[model samples]
Target: MDSIRLKIDSRADQVALAGRCIHALSKVVVGERAAFEIELAACEVINNVIEHAYECREGNDILIEWIHRDGELQIDVHDWGRAVPADVLFSPLPDIDHGDVTNLPEGGFGIGLLNALSDRVEYRTDEDEGRNTLSLFRRFDAAGISR
Candidate 1:
């Protein structure tokens, strides 16, 4: 198994760094396409933590951790900001297919995107601990095709 933990400030500029690091680490364990997918998912989670949880505030702590074993990858993102509403966190994916293209939202689609990109997604918050975690899981075959 391979694992790493990363900590960064809740700032927009730091997102790019996290993306790059995630991509590089994932590429080593999976194919380029799979790595890119993980990178995108991680970025979306981080952005949500910053914008929604931290309200775009800087200097707040965001922690990311990745673990790979048995051709499965698990990524966890933790933040010490506001807890996400259960309704929003567990909502079903938006039905964008039936909507008008122009009427579509430019953002607020991260949850759906994350669900589409990963094999599994989970979100948890502990009020007493003041921590929220978002976890993503993906599996790959020997050929590096995501399953």
Candidate 2:
């Protein structure tokens, strides 16, 4: 098992960090396709924190950790931000109305994608501490590849 921790400042930095992690893990985990899926999933979660958690506030820190063990991948993302609303947390994707391009919102897609890509997704928030934690998990096969 291996673990790495990083503190990211900006959205671009977060994406870069995700890319780096993916590159490092890919060496150990086989199958480029599965690796790319995991990397994309991580990017969506990290970007969510960068855009919504801090609301573009400067100096807000996001902590990202990756854990690999027993043919499984675990990613933890932590941030200090306003507590996410319970409704928003569990809300289903909105149905497309007439497929109008302009009517569609740019946001909410990330959360939807995260839920779809990862095998497991969990969230924890402490209002008093203003902490939000997102945990993602994907189980891999003996070949170090996910299904």
- Leading candidate by lDDT: 1
Give the Å error, residue 77, model 2: 0.4
Each prediction's Cα RMSD? 1.9, 2.6
Q: Worst lDDT window (10 residues) for model 2?
A: 85-94
Encode model 1's per-residue lDDT on 9-73: one tens digit a residue.
99999999999999999998897999999999889889999999999999899999988988799
TM-score, every prediction: 0.90, 0.81
Candidate 2 lDDT over 18-127, as tens digits, reads: 66676568556756776777777778777777777777676888888888888788888889976566556554455677769889776677777777778888899877
Clashes of each: 0, 0
